[model samples]
Target: MKRTEAEQFTRRLTHHGEGPVWLGHHGLAVLDMLAGDVVLIDDSGAETRREHLGAVVAALRPRRDGGFVAGLERGFCLLNDRFTVTETVTCWTSPDVRMNEGACDPQGRFWCGSMAYDLTPGAGALWHLDPTGAAVQAIAGIGCSNGLAWTRDGTRGYYVDSLTGRVDILELRPDGAIANRRPFVDVTGEGFPDGIAVDQADGVWLAMFGSGLLLHFDRTGRRDAEIAVPVRQVTACTFAGPDYSELYITTSRYGLTDPEAAAGAVFRARPDVGGFAPYAFSG
Candidate 1:
């Protein structure tokens, strides 16, 4: 197989950034796992970091009216207009899990996953939070829920469990419950799947952590394209820039040796692919 080519965009400090989502009409939001913070990086590349959040941050998404919402290792929190913590939902009670990856459904529901900190399989669950702040565990015994995306029409939901090396698709019901759980894709060899994003054409871009490659799959999970990066621990990616043509990738140096540390940096590249508009939490 031929090597995939990729171009670097920008190099910044983000230790173990797991989830990156674009804030419509604004900038980008990232979850810093080491600092346990939700950081907002504007269009100019200036970042405002909210620190000392919790154990570890797993995912972040923007609220419709401004502010943001983040999921941490311990629970979930709401960021107010001023980016302050307005409310927090802890996960220390039942199930004893940590938040992993999450995204807002088309209907404005926040869905996030929880897993054990030790990378133990079958020790986590998927949860959903409604507009009114009510939280419920939707699925249990999830190994490591990592990537999340939705179809264009908002009728299908795709989720990845890293440990299983499988991506599952579900039919989105009217009541926010998922049905028809089936394997959409299976990745073998080299890297494990970490984060994902869906394009306007319904293509899925998956970040392969250990392989240092981003694999693009069609709606049916067939390999469409691949892009290479210098970093071995690329955690997540999203479309940014003026026309939403540039793909911004976030990487990490966590668990890396000296050689790998040098390559742990955020990158950008134009894949000649069109991405979908990011979903905002209007509720």
Candidate 2:
């Protein structure tokens, strides 16, 4: 039953800020999802950089080789040192579906999920892109594929298919493949779970879109606390800041009617535990 409030960290910088990641030495990066923009915000919150990638850019993460791997509209792409895309791989030819949210596993493979732009049921799926540039469909018939994260030990994973109204737990095999899947938490009556972050303690911090709350579930999946963000369309979150003690949240102005000034802004709050830096894409 613990509760806390998040403070605004930036102005209304994105129309639909979806994925937020902390790139250790590179600062914070969040995607303006439907706008195809990759935004970089300095630590001081005094500077911001926007780079347009395509018609839509869903998610992004740093690369181990000094660049980045991003989920573009239909597939994925590799960015160079300057953050310019050097290669693109299209996994599907469907103009109706697009990549959504994702994260890198401990083994350095990037996993992103997709959803039909029209929100058609069972038209989306989860995809995994290994370090060798090959891709595979990990889960099919996904309604709204979103939020993916792994535990510090890489033994477990948390995945969200918004349409299911639940977060599913995953058992990761030694080769990084999924061994099993089951329900971890059912959020049917609450708002949709958009994004999540797993702390070093294996706790899951989830952003409940439209609920304006970031829920904290302990290792056993019991709800322990809720962090309130000022904006209602809270989309995603990640642990950042110096010691990874700060939780950074992204909000969306996508469907709001005359949304408030902070609707599309990013927010931050310090939680009780710390989180590990996002895994870098090895490919």
> What pairs collide in candidate 2?
none
Residue-level error in angstroms, candidate 2, position 131: 0.7
Worst 10 residues of 1 by lDDT: 1-10
Off by over 4 Å in 1: 1-4, 44-52, 94-96, 259-263
Task: Tell me each candidate's RMSD, in Å, in order.
Answer: 2.3, 1.0
List the candidates' TM-scores in order: 0.91, 0.98
lDDT of 2 at 88: 91
Over 1-283, each residue of candidate 1 has an lDDT whose tens digit, in order, gives 2346666544555777667777765567666776786666776566755455777777777787787777766677887766678888876665456788888888888888887878788998888778788787888888988888887778777788898887778777788877678988889665788888877777788999888888888887888788888877787888876577878788887776664643545677677667766665654
Query: How many collisions per candidate?
Result: 1, 0
lDDT by residue (142-203, candidate 2, tens digit) is: 99999899999888899999999999998877666678999999899899888999999999
lDDT of 1 at 39: 68
Instruction: List runs of model 2 lying over 4 Å from the truth.
Output: none
